[model samples]
Target chain A: MKKFVQVEDVGMRFDTKKGPFVALRDVDLAIEKGEFIALIGHSGCGKSTLLNLIAGLTVPTDGVLICDGREIAGPGPEREVVFQNHSLLPWLTCFENVYLAVERVFGAKEGKPKLKLRTQEALALVGLTHAEQKYPHEISGGMKQRVGIARALSMQPKVLLMDEPFGALDALTRARLQDELMKICDATGATVVMVTHDVDEAVLLSDRIVMMTNGPAATIGEILKVELPRPRNRLELAHDPRYIDYRAAVLSFLYEKQAHHEKQAA
Target chain B: MSAITFEKALEAGAAAAVAEPAVVAVARSEPAASAASTASVASSAVPVARDGGAPSPKPESRAGEWLRAAARATLPPAIGLAVMIGIWYLATLSAGGSLPGPVQTWEAAVKLFADPFYSNGPNDQGIGWNVLSSLQRVGIGFGIAALIGIPLGFLLGRFATLSSMVNPIISLLRPVSPLAWLPIGLLVFKKADPAATWTIFICSIWPMIMNTAQGVTRVPSDYMNVARVLNLSEWKIFTKILFPAVLPYMLTGIRLSIGTAWLVIVAAEMLTGGVGIGFWVWDEWNNLKVEHIIIAIFVIGIVGLLLEQMLIAIAKRFSYE
Candidate 1:
């Protein structure tokens, strides 16, 4: 399969006051079109750093990142990111928040009403049609995150990049949003690169899980393919032997091999 | 408020319901959330949106509760004012009549306000004209300050180099008393009125510039990231993300600037001998009318409080959480 997003030896370094701090070094990953890939790692593992690099929120110190056969230059509407904090402008209503992204992406090609329709449709996709006029402050945490997702999706971006999208949400809201995300991906065929710490979540949602070793200079450790078929049910998977195998594999990589760092810290 | 209460009750019930059954919880929360949104939109605010949407109290005692809340809110300020008056009266008695008592000041205020807009030439105008003239100066000075300062702040906040360049200048000048600028103003303009306005403009500009810069720089990284990912235009970023995010801080700056401007205006007017409350107070002092001076002080205090409150209300409107 042709790679949709190709990261060739991507490296990220921040010049801290003390010295140069390498967050990600020589990280190579190729994501095929329509693939849902999760990057999992321990804390300080730079999973989000890689995702940011992919989103062009940050540039790599070395190596090339190509998206859709073009060099990734800077952040654009083509790669919409659902920020971890659900960074909806607090002043805007949910509909307006979604509309902002929709208008930016589709407004040039479509009329005002069509743009508005897209916003409403995006909100409806997230099961938040009723929350159209509510401000970010007025909504629940999960609802706010949903609006963030809605905003990203409303853009109809080629690549949907999420940075621990459901990390802040409660377990129930997390589960619900995951199901909604799966459905959205199915409907839109969005190529997604999501960062997650949860083993089950990565296993349950992604076509492949790219595990990263702990930083100082974090790099990809291993990539595990999730062979479980789509239209996946969390409950059904809870009892599936294959699901257990995938979940256990990720858990082992994170806890067993990565347990070396935990011991050193201890 | 009723709608807020209902929503609270519904959320509380919904949270408990979630623990038992997901299907039931979803069914319950969906309707409740919609009802809450409508109620909130209709009413403009739902107070119980805070506090984790706690179950509202029983509805029968609402009027009584409101009455109690109102009393609780208003009683302390009333008591404090009364105490202040009592102290003022006692202090006057102790001071051997240098200061007029509250009653004397109140009597003078009543007589003065009776024909407040009267004009017996520019220097001997009514209290209303004096107050209006002072407000006009503040308006002009403050308006110009905002026009210049806000944009400067945005630039300073946007660029580190500009901020660095101006930081020392701002720091050096910011601490100087606004009235001290009166000499430069008078020298430049060769007139009292324009000098007073210049003082106000200079003083008000600092707060607005400092605050706006502070607001712009302090914009959350998340919001900037949103702008980046959206690949919004510079204009769109300013309009959509930057402006709204910095609004609360801008209002703060405006509030502070106005406060300083109002303060500067009175002092400037005193020095300049203008047709304003500050000049009126000085004129009354020249005539040895201590009661009128006291009245002017009260008027200034009241006006400042009103201005602060108005700005506060505006700030509240823009604040999201």
Candidate 2:
């Protein structure tokens, strides 16, 4: 069977003052429907570049990306991106922010009432029902990130692309949000491609962790399939040898094999 | 036991003195009163004995605290005004009564305001009418400027080619004196009122254009990225992402534009020979009514301050964070 999403030998190059800076090269990945995949690497590894390419926020300099049996031409409502900094429009309330997406995606066929209901349901999914009227600035960082997720999910996109969605959050909030994300994915059966630098977050939330080699020309170095059972608890996984092994595999790929010596020197 | 109450009062007094300069005198007297009470209570070794008396003073002190704060807030500006008037009086003395003193200016101001809206003729209206006409001219000129400049600013900001083309011209003309435009205005409009307004328009447009364009350019790319990812239409991008992000900057531009318009109106009115505060000042100077000229200065300063403050209040309301 064909994959739900495909990145075929994709490469991204940015024209900088120095020269054509290659960010990613020969990156190929296939994601099945409802599979939660995490892109893990050090900083400057172009994991976000890969995510952006998939989101169609930026087209790859070479090669093609296909999603849901269509070549990604440009950024569309079908590929929703959850940005790293929780880019909620500060002027908009949390409800309105999510509603902007819902209106765009479903407003043509749906009535205003239906659109409103979808927005409210999306916020409820993220457990932000209490903060529908509050502006992004009025809420905490974690709540803003949740609102960001709500906005992405409100679109009911084919693939949810998150670029370190919980990276800016505190440790406890990150754990809570990770667990919530796992539950959310389980419930909604979302096909997710998340970019994260956190090891535990990858092992806990993802079906497969795509460990990227460090860039000048970064590519997927290793892919680990996480076979941990559903209803996975972090507490149980803390002692689970399988979970530990998956985490260690990712850690070894990131640190031992593809260790960034140039970054350390800098 | 009374010693502790006395010490507490002394500490309170010290804290009060540190917090409020106006309260220093009241705080100083508290210690003396408490010391006298402590001496009287020396024989009675009961702390509860002074508690009732202490609570009475506490209420009094609270009342005095706010009163002192109010005094502190108002006193400096009052003193500054007095010092200014004193210097004016001394200057009159030095000039041997040739210059109008503060009292002379005040009496003139009082008489001038008594029938402020009077109009003897087109050129000889009351100070209030003159001031109003000047403001009206500014409003027309500034309204026109805003109507044109803001949209133009957005266009320039949104398109790089347009900005690069127009920016050089703006940079060249922006530094030219607003008064220089008055002659050009007079030539084109063929009337003093419209000409003065034209000058205000020309003077005000640059700041609005520049600031707004700058604001548009500075809208965080992250918001734009969100816009792109959403695949928002042009109108949606402009309304949802661009407009709110640029509002504060637009307000800043407007504030600056209004300030420039007000400043230019006076000078433009003076040169254009209209019934305006600036013309009234020149007319008073011509009539040797220096006191009225001084009053006009105060009026202009106060009106400018009020205009600035109003815009600031509006800008504050629009600010998102």
Candidate 3:
């Protein structure tokens, strides 16, 4: 499979008064077209930092990132990110939030209602056709995350980046939205790189889960291909033998990394 | 801990923190988790079509709706005036002063409005004329301040270094009394026309400037990041994102400015000895007309309240999502 996005030995660092802190060090990864990849790590493991670099919201301190065969320079409509907080403008209704991105990316020259059609389509795609006029504050946490997804999808991006989009939501809502998101991915075939801490959510949603080590400077510990068939049911997949091994593998990788860090600290 | 024990510990901790009836109070005051679960179920039963539907208005009877609308639109001072008069009538009977009651005040208010023109003698302008003059001065001063302050505020706010540099100067000027500025303004402008207005401007601009800067600085980090991520042009960011984001604060500042303007306007008028509510009050005090002074005080309060309410209404419209 051809690489759709490439992170070529990318390294990122932040300057603080204390000293220079490395978030990611000499990390390289490739994501293929139409692939759903989950990157999981604890906070400060630079999962979001890596996602931001790939999205071109921040430049890597060393090396390069390429998206859709082009060197990434800055954020554009092609690499849309649905942030962890949902980042929905509180003032805009669900439809309007989606419409805003659509208008910015593809508004009519005549200023006629081009945004309305795309926004309506995006909301419908997210199963939020009726929630078009409701503000972010008016919606449930899960629904707001859905609106964030709709807003990102409305941009018609090549790579959709989700930064723990369902982390704030309740368990049931998160599960339901996860199901809807899978349906969205299957329909659109848009490649996704989602950052999550939930082992179940990652297992259920991704074609592969990339687990990262804890950071003083973090790197990918392992990438496990999830061979679970598509239209995967979370509860059903939990019962499957293959999923059980996959969960154990990911958990052990995380646990092994934790033990290594604790030994280092001691 | 095992996941089940973790769950149990959390539940037990919550339960033990509150006594039984106190737990009931918490449950009643806040809808229970079960209620939210039920609501979610009920919500899902509604077709997804209703999720993004137009927001439901607060339920109210037709008459009640009309009354709420009226109350929202009504001037607070007018409502305050009615209440004050009701209290005043009771007070007058109890105090048994030679002073008149609500009926007498109404009669006085009516007589002042009856002539509808300037008085023949010097320093004897009608209340209406005096109010208009005061308004004119406030308008000029406030207009000048807004023109100067808002742009400067935007600049100061957008640049942290610049704000730090200018902040000390602002602090220095802000605390100095508006009354102190009145004498300086009188000396500097050396004319009643602009100088009196300048006093109002200096006093009023402090709040507008500070609040506008605060508003600009306090624009949500998420929105700023969104603006940055989009790589929006500076002008586009200012007009579309920055301006709208800071609008509520600007309006709030304007309301505060108006109140300051009114406060300073009267003082300015008293010092300048020109035609305004403040001048009217001072002139009445000189003549020892206590009733006229009371009337002027009421007028100032009513006008100030109306101005603030109008600004509040405008702010509310733009601030709500």
Candidate 4:
């Protein structure tokens, strides 16, 4: 498989008053181009820390992260993030929020009209054209997340990183957004690394699931490739033995192997 | 019924502004027949014109409701004022008229406002002139503070070391009364007006810096992450994200600073012996014109209230939520 994003011997350590806190260590992963990869782990397992590393929001204490054959120095529009809280700037209209991203990424080469067109197109893609003029607060949680997705995709980044994008939403909204995300991925052919705890979501959306061991020093314990064909339906997958087996493998790994001690402590 | 519809339309806020002209235009250019057709489509908006986008029922009732709301909002303040005045009148009567009653104050107010802009000499001027001179000083002092303080606030908020160094100094200086600086101002400027303004500056600068620094530091880490992920230039981050995000906090600082400036200007002017409301109040008291002094108090209060309300309205307008 062709690697689009390369993470080599990545480790992260945060300094606390007590001592040095090791979140991730010896974590190595290579994500292919146009691949849907899910980083799955229990809470406080540094799944988000790893995603932030990939997004270049945080520098790994050790090792290197490279995107599109270039060393990731710091965060750039090339690596876009859809944050957990749907971190849309509340002051801006949904259109303006996405437009800010579009302007940053393409504004240098593109004219004003083209930038606007890109913003409108991105909003339309997320089915939020009607809410383009509304502020983030006026919209529902699901809608805000959609706008968050729109803002990220509007950048047309090389790799899309989402840290628990739908984690805050209701189950129905989460399911609906998962489907929307799958469609967006299929259409854009963008490499995506999403951190999610939902086992079903991992199997449904990701080409491969990267589950981590429990922290002090968390590392990739298992990488399961879902061989399900494209356009998989959730209803049909419920009864699919392969899907059940994949879910069980992740569930057992999380509960039995890793345990939930870190979460309890946190 | 038409009254209700118009009021409901006003509450809707969608077609509210244009609708009046549209209503007038329809009345003029189109026939009454066409106007009736559009009216049905207009009322279905938030009534929330909430769910069914259908014609509204009895917006006439909404007008009554709006009026009732207005009354509900205003009644308490009016009643509270009345009660306070009644107590004042009773107290004045009981104490053998040492303090002026509400009616006496009202009469004095009317006479004082009759020619508020009159100018007799350098020391003798109308209440308006006094108020304006005071405002001019406050404006100069507060403007200078804002020019320096807001940017410094951003820096303090951004750099922890700088904030740490300055935070102790601010904590020490902030509690020193605005008038306490008046002597220092007098010693430096060697002029009454600049001295008064300096007092205002020293008093006002603290809030602007403190609040702005607080705003900058309190900026949601999420926004900073957005800036980082976008790889926005330092200028872009400041202009687009940081500026807008921190604006409410900055305005809050401005509001607080202006309030302190206004408050300090009065006392500073009294000490500095300038042509200001505070000086006028002292002048009136020395002349044994207590009623005029009372009138000055009301004028000062009303002006302060107006200034506060203006800032509040601006804050409300700019608020993201």
Tens digits of per-residue lDDT for model 4, A1-266: 48889999999999999999999999899999999999998877889999999988889999999898998878888889999999998988999899988998898999999999999999999999999999999999999999999999999998999999999999999999999999999999999999999999999999999999887788999999999999889999999999999999999988888785655566
Enumerate residue pairs that collide in model 2. Answer: none
TM-scores of all predicted structures = 0.87, 0.89, 0.79, 0.87
For each candidate in the order shown, give its overall lDDT on alpha carbons. 0.87, 0.85, 0.79, 0.84
Two-chain DockQ for each candidate model: 0.62, 0.81, 0.23, 0.61
* Candidate 4 lDDT, B67-152, residue by residue in tens: 45655564455444433444454455456766776657767777888999999997889999999999999899999999999999
Lowest lDDT sum, 10 consecutive residues, model 4 chain B, at B28-37
Q: Which stretches of candidate 4 lie over 4 Å from their true place?
A: A260-266, B1-71
* Candidate 2 lDDT tens digits, B1-321: 433443344444445544665335353634444453445343342333344335675755554555456455644554344334444554564577789876677677789999999988897999889989999999999999999999999999999999999999999999999999888988998888889988999999998898889989999999999999988889999999998998898999888988988887878777878789989988888999999988988999999999999999998988887
Per-residue CA lDDT of candidate 1, range B39-98, in tens?
444343234232323445654356446545655564455444544554465466557789
**What is each candidate's fraction of native interface contacts (fnat)?**
0.97, 0.94, 0.33, 0.91
CAPRI tier for the interface of model 2: high
Question: Model 2, A49-113: lDDT tens per residue?
Answer: 99989988888889999998999989988889999999999999999999999999998999999
Interface RMSD, prediction 3: 2.4
Summarize candidate 3's per-residue lDDT along B1-321 as a digit string, tens digits. Answer: 122222233244335434454344333322332333334333443443243332445423443454445444543433343334434544554567656655565566678768746776657888888999999999999998999888888988999999999999998889888878766776887787677898888988988888899999999887876665555668767876789889999998889999999988888898788778888899988887667777788899999999989998899888855
Rank the models by DockQ, top first.
2, 1, 4, 3
lDDT: which is higher, 2 or 3? 2
Measured by TM-score, the strongest candidate is 2
- Which number leads on DockQ? 2
Please report, as a residue range, the 10-residue window in candidate 1 chain B with the lowest summed lDDT: B44-53
Instruction: Please list the residue runs of candidate 1 whose C-alpha ends up more than 4 Å from where it truly belongs after superposition.
Output: B1-70
True lDDT of residue B61, candidate 3? 43
CA shift of B74, model 2, Å: 2.8
What is the docking quality class of candidate 1? Answer: medium
